[model samples]
Target chain A: MERKWNKSSLMGWQFVALPSALILLFSFYPMFQSLLLSFQSGKGTVYHYVGIDNYIRLFSDPMFKQAVFNTLLYLIVQVPIMLLLGLVIAHLLNNPKLRFKGFYRTAIFLPCVTSLVSYAVLFKSIFAVDGILNKMLLSMHVIQEPIAWLMDPIWARVVIIAAITWRWTGYNMIFYLSAMQNIDPSIYEAASIDGASKTRQFFSITVPMLKPIILFTAIISTNGTLQLFDEVVNITKGGPGNATMTISQYIYNLSFVYTPNFGYAATVSYAIVVMVAVLALFQLKLGGEKR
Target chain B: MKKLTTMVVHLFLIVASVISLFPFVWMLMGMTNSSSEILKGKFSFGSMLMENIHKLLDMTSLGAAFWNSAIIAIIGTVGTLLLSSMAGYGFEIYHSKSKSRLFGLLMLSMMMPFAAVMIPLFRMFSGMGLLNTPTAVILPTITTAFMIFFFLQNTKSFPRELLQAGRVDGLSEWRLFTRIYMPTMKPTYAAAAIITFMNYWNSFLWPLIALQTQDKKTLPLVVSSLASSYNPDYGIIMVAIVITTLPSVLIFFLLQKQFVQGMLGSVK
Candidate 1:
């Protein structure tokens, strides 16, 4: 029995060993190396230990600050809007009386199929100075002139936000829709029978019932927004004076686009890690405490 | 008044659906229109489809990019599913206190942003003389913690009785895993495959950095350059985008149930 137990345990290690090793090498090891790299200031291989310097630079760095501010603006503004839109859509679709549910669901969920870059490019062209959107708006007489959407800082950010919202709203909706399915309809039925309005039922029941999923979507959206790279890079190019530049794009620019500043890029990368850690912790707290 | 409200609701939904699907429609139309014609808001399909395809093929390594993307996505998805399922199974089926702790640790890595690890990963891959290879992209992500977690979560409902039953039949542990466990987890594997495949297909940041040369770049990377170019041809770019997007979209539609199941698998 002792030998058999030992053999089984060994088999367990055999299964897990390679994958764990790969994770340790690829994920954990690079993470540790990045931490070490963060401390040393250098362009490329030539480097020296500059303890606390990169961390200090982060506080006053304008580009860093702008990136952080833009990312948070997206987080604060876009996440709530997208999630709310998703919830509303999901709720609407959850209605038994709604016609053509399949068509609506599929049509609305279609945007998520586009690759991030493809969508960004699409949005970019549509919002271009003389692009389709401008032409449409012109025909509608909404604006006398083309908006120069991606060329302006503010409109560029809006376009970025709109692009992201377009891509992910369906994704979040699917989650809410699935979670809504698990909800017993009798609760909503009871509420309605007791003279509750649809709005009140949605707020009191659907929202509350989908709290965990809401929290889950929030965490992922927050995480995705924090590490936002593809859209910002493709749509705006973090340009019109870096208004839509995310920290990830900033890090990419630092390490690769500009003269490769490995150490400082690593430092900039830490800011995202810290933000993700904080937001994730705060969300977990928010979710757990409410539950 | 109730009828009016219902009309308003339907109108809102119709508007939203149109807004959502307009880009896909425009993209398809752009294939048949010239760059200027597209910018001028030509809603109808023009005669530029063959021209766009020819120009895209002629001007870029579109074929090689597609081939590379396919190879990477297929291999990466297979590897991710197999290895992650193995670890998930090992940790679940052969439960131990240490394995649990290790898994918890692995989960922590999931929260570590790719930006943080990317520089080092690039350096690590470069050092190993594997920077330009598909191996670099696949290796780091091959055994992701989230995939492992997904597999572990799905594996909970797996029948342990089957494993015990297999053991009694005198099959070796490896044989039991390959023959029995894998066969039973087909749905979970299918779900994971679609998600992993899409991820690999659409992956950009890492591939943008890793695959430097024209010949080795993925479709997304190629499309990115086309879009970013000074004299961008919207017709050709649209064709390239369609090609890059078609496989995943097809996969999503074909195995859509599994894709949704896979996505929700993580949330659960």
Candidate 2:
């Protein structure tokens, strides 16, 4: 039943139109302004149009390249592990015989709820040169001396990846768990009656069922990891010669920490937009078509 | 082997929980210890909790900062829910190809990292002479694409028959939304309010950029700046962290039932 468009109806449309227009204005205007600013170059308040120069400079800049590599590395390495672990744990939790489900769920989910400052401080202390981790490793005969988890380049990246995975796996698991609740238990029962192993049921039934939400979380996680800043900044300060610097952290440093290179920073920001758009497009193509 | 695997998963979950809770435990212990004892990594309670609390109160304008955070969060959350839910209701009920394309474009904005736009956003506010205003921080955030996306997703399951019935009863569109749709969507609104409040209360970046004066600083920014000092007092920082984290946790605890209830509607 279509409601006829009337005066009050038109007024409601007008009201909705105004807010949507304002939202589009704020969201698009700054983005376009940033695009314009990216073409111009200079120190604070003095600038000139330098079309393609900022892009060229970005291409040539070693730091930007390193940031790109680190962000991509984190994206490639961390996303799959977190998603798989989330799926596995979620499947296990979905088991009918699993006990203490609330305790397990809350325990795993607590990491993300911890304030960012505490997590940073905690990680820093635990990974310090003579920290508890090293002491444990030494006494356990796992290491000859100490592993400077944050000071070394490779180990620092590993630690950051581990940190992200630890904090987010449970969060992603919650999404899967919530999604799992919507599935009919009868389907799993049918699978078990057909003599499907739990592992077989997971791969064939659960994974296929969760494909869309999995893709949604995956894309969001990609964007999140690509823009990773807080943990890196707070934990290592993107330190040891920018070994762990992410695109977002680099953009932050360019904007605030170093000289205010707003133009190049905007260009770098567009790089993130481009990457996320590409990945999202691919995800939609692969996952969105599913019913 | 199955039993062994179950045991391993249990062990892993226990370890993760300990690691997760360790910082909170440490922060509490730090609050109860002298600064020297904290730096020495004292892991137990001491005689210094009251002293640390007194020092925190004396040194910083914690009361004012807390009030500022509350005010901003409340206003921001309320404004966001009203405008965003309105738009979500409008779009979902009135879906067209054009509006769908516009929604797609809106989701694009959500993916762009906030840091990339930080400078231009700061410049825009400064140019508008709005620096140091809570409005400067609250306005841009209130109409977030993420929240809009959330509302739109939730609104998809909204019963359109309610609107048809309202129209049949000769209700205006706005009246239909306010009377019928809004009441039915109470659970969604409650969940959105909690998430939005937590987000605003924990917001750090934009406030740090826009708010310049001492009185304007929010709790997280104040705690961060305090922690950045040359001889950072671990005891006081611990106190400040506790203060900063309490409101979000409290809000979560209060609204968690609604939150979990709404999650089923959300993930679809």
Candidates in order have lDDT scores of 0.91, 0.79
Write candidate 1's Cα lDDT for B220-247 as tens digits.
9988999889878999999999998898
Q: Which candidate number would show the highest lDDT if scored against the true structure? A: 1
Q: How accurate is candidate 1 locally (lDDT)?
A: 0.91
Model 2: per-residue lDDT, tens digit, A122-190? Answer: 566557676556776788999998888888999999988888887788779988998898999999899
What DockQ number belongs to candidate 2? 0.43
The number of residue pairs in model 1 that clash at the backbone is 0
* DockQ for candidate 1, C-alpha atoms: 0.79
Scored against the true structure, residue B33 in model 1 reaches a CA lDDT of: 96
Error of 2 at B6 (Å): 3.4
Candidate 1: tens digits of C-alpha lDDT, residues A179-277: 999999999989999999989999999998899999989998999999999998888789989899999999999999998999999999999999999
Q: Which residue segments of model 2 deviate by more than 4 Å?
A: A1-12, A130-132, A135-141, A144-146, A286-291, B96-98, B164-171, B261-265
Task: Report the number of the highest-DockQ candidate.
Answer: 1
